[model samples]
Target: MKELRSQAIVLRTMPLGEADKLVTMLTREAGKVKAVARGSRKTKSKFSALVEPLTLGSFLLHAGKTFYTFIQGELLKSYTGLQHDLERFVHAQYFCEICDRCLPEGEPAEAVFHLLLTALETLEVDPHPARVARCFELNLLEELGLKPALDACRICGKSGGPFRFDPLEGGLVCAECPRPASSFPVSAASLAVMKRLLAYGFQKLSVCLLSPQSQSEIHQVCLGLFQHIFDVRSLRSLQFLKAGKPS
Candidate 1:
C-alpha cells in the first residue's frame, strides 16, 4: 500500500496474464524496480506506450508484497530515434540488458541512472555506435566500482606500454610483468583509445577515429573484463547484434 514516485526509464517489459505486464525499470531514486501494470496490454491502456523499453517517464506505483503495481505515469522521452536503425536498436537493448542484469534491485543509483540516460541521448544523435557502446561499458563499469586499472602496470607500477590486459588481475600488465594465461595483448593505439575514452568522457568521443583493429581490441578488452567481473558470459542482445552483422 506504500506509494512510490520516481523518474524512471523502462528497461524491460513482458505480457502478464493477458491484460497486465511485468515491467522492469531503472529509476533515479531507486536503482531498478519491477512492477505489474494492470491492463497494459489493452488497446486503450494508459500504460500501453508508457511501459515500452527505453521510455523515460515520471511514474507512480504502489508497493506490493512481491512487486510494485503501476498506478500512473507521464512520458518524458520515448527515444524513438533508436527504433529507426536496426543496429542502434540492438545496441540500445544491449545497454539496457547490462543495466538490468548488473544493478542491484531497489538500491539508489543516481549516478548510474544519469550515465545510462546520457548514453542513450548520445546514441540517439551519434552515428558511431561502437564508440558509444564502448564508452557506456567503460563508464558503467566505473560506476559499478568494477573499473579496471588501465593507467599503469598492475604489479610493477610501470607506466609504459606494450601491455596486456588481465581481467582477473583487473588491469594492464606491462611486458616486464609476469603474464597470466588469461591476459591478452593490448596494442598501443587501442590502449590510447581506451585511456582517452575513460579520460575525456563521451562528449569527445566524436573526435576519435577508430581503426578496425583498435575497435576490435577495445571490444575484446572491455568484454573480457565485463564477463569476468559480472560472471555474465552471454548476452542475448549481443548475440542478435553479431548474427545481424553483414558478412
Candidate 2:
C-alpha cells in the first residue's frame, strides 16, 4: 500500500463498523478525503483525540484498495479551548462546512486549509468569533473567484468612498451608479468596514470595531453573497449567535 502525508483539519466524523470511524478531512494537499480510522473509538486508541472534529494535524494515510486507512496521526493543535464553548464549536463547524462546499475536486487548497486552521485558532484565542467569521467569509469569496467589488461600483469604474453590496447584481454598487434592484440597505460606514475586510488581511481587522447595527449589516451583506455563490444560508453557528448575546 502507498502512504501519503498531508496537513488536514478534521471536518467531521461518523461511526463506521464497530470500533472504527469514518473521518472526513479538508486537506491542504488534497481537496478533501474520507478515510477509515481503525479502532479510533477504542478507549486506549492513540487516535482518539487526534481524530475528533476541529483537529489540526498531519496524518499518514495508507491508500488501500477500498479506502484510505489512518496509519498514524500527530496533533498540532486540538483546539481544546474552543470546545468548552458551544458558540465557538458552532462557528468552527459552519466554517468547515462552507470550505468543504466551495473547494473543487482534485484541487489542492493549501491557502484555504491554512486560513481555516488559523481562523479557528483566531476564534480560540480572540474574543471575536463573529468578526473572524466575517473575515473568513470575505476571504472565501475572494478565493473562490467571487471577489466583491470593493474598489468601485460594478456598473461604473469610479473609485470612491461609499458603496453597497448588491447581491442580485453580485458586487458593490456606488451611490451614483445604482441599479433598479439595488434596494438593499447599507450605510457608508458599514460598506467601508466590509471593504476593509475584503481588501486587507485578517490582522488588519484585529483592531477594528463596529456598532451593533453595523455588525448586522456586514453579516447580512456577506450572508447574501454566501447564499448567491454557495446557495446556502449563513453559517449554522450564526443561528446560535443570533439567538442570544455573546459571552
Candidate 3:
C-alpha cells in the first residue's frame, strides 16, 4: 500500500465498531478523503482529539481498496474556541457541511481548502457570525463557478441602482427591467454590502457592518441562489441555526 501525507481539516467523524472511527477530512492536496481511524474512539488514542470536526492537522495514511487508513496525525489547530458559543459552532458546522457536499473526493481543491481554513480563523475572531457565514457562502459560490452576476442587471445589462435579485435568472435585474415571477426587491445598501463581501478577504470582514434589513436581504438572496444552483433541499446545520435564532 502507498503512504500519503497532507495537510487536512477534519470535516466529520462517525463511530465505527467499538474504538475506531470513520473520519472525513478535506486535505490541502488531496481534497476530500474518508479514512478509517483505528482506535480513534478510545480515550488514550492520539488521534481522538485531532479527528474532531474543524480540527486542522497533518495526516499520514495508507491507501486501501475503498478507503484510506489513518496511521498518524499531527495537530495544527483545534479551533476549540467554536465550542464556547453555540452560534459560532453551528455556523462552523454549516461551513464544514457545505464543503463536504460541494467537494469531490480525491480532487485537488486547494482554493476551497484555504478558504475554509481562513473562514474558521475568521469565525474565531469575528464578532458577527452571520457576516462570516454570508461571506463564506459568497466565496464558496465563486469558487464553485456559480457566482451570480452583481455588476449589472441580468436582464437588460444595465449598470447602477436599486436592483431586484432574481435567483431563477441567476443575478440582479434593474428597476427598469420587468421583474421575473421569482424576483425579490434588493436595496442599494444590501447590494453594496454583497459586492464588498464578495470582493474583500476574510481578514477585512471584522470591520464590515450591515443593517438588519441588509443582512436579511443578503441572506435571502444567497440562500435562494444556493438552492436554485445546487438543488440542495436543505442543510441540517442551517436548520439548527435557524431553530436557535430568537425568531
Separately for all candidates shown, the number of backbone clashes (residues 3 or more apart, or on different chains) is: 0, 0, 0
Q: TM-score of predicted model 3?
A: 0.93
Over 4 Å off in model 3, which ranges? 231-233
Highest TM-score, which number?
1
lDDT of 1 by residue, 121-214 (tens): 9988887887888888888888888777888999899999889999888799999989999999888898888888888778798898788788
Model 3 — which ten-residue stretch has the worst lDDT?
225-234
**Cα RMSD, each candidate:** 1.6, 2.5, 1.8
Residue 82 of model 2 has an lDDT of: 78
Put the candidates in lDDT order, highest first. Answer: 1, 3, 2
**Per-residue C-alpha lDDT of model 2 across residues 1-247, encoded as one tens digit per residue:** 5877998898878999999999888888886777899999999999999999888889999877766899989998787567687777778877877876667644787888878877887888667777887788878887777766666677887777466668766667777874547447677788778778877858777786767777888777777777776755655555666675553
Q: Assess each prediction's global lDDT (C-alpha) against the native.
A: 0.87, 0.77, 0.86
* Cα lDDT, model 3, residue 183: 91
For model 2, where is the 10-residue window of minimal lDDT?
A: 231-240
Give the alpha carbon lDDT tens digit for every residue of 1-247 in model 3.
6987999999999999989999889999888999999998999998898899889999999989888998888999998679889889898999998888777888889999999999999889888888888899888888887787888998778888688899887799888988788999899888888888888857578788978888788878878877885644477898897778612
| Candidate 1 Cα errors over 4 Å, as ranges | 245-247
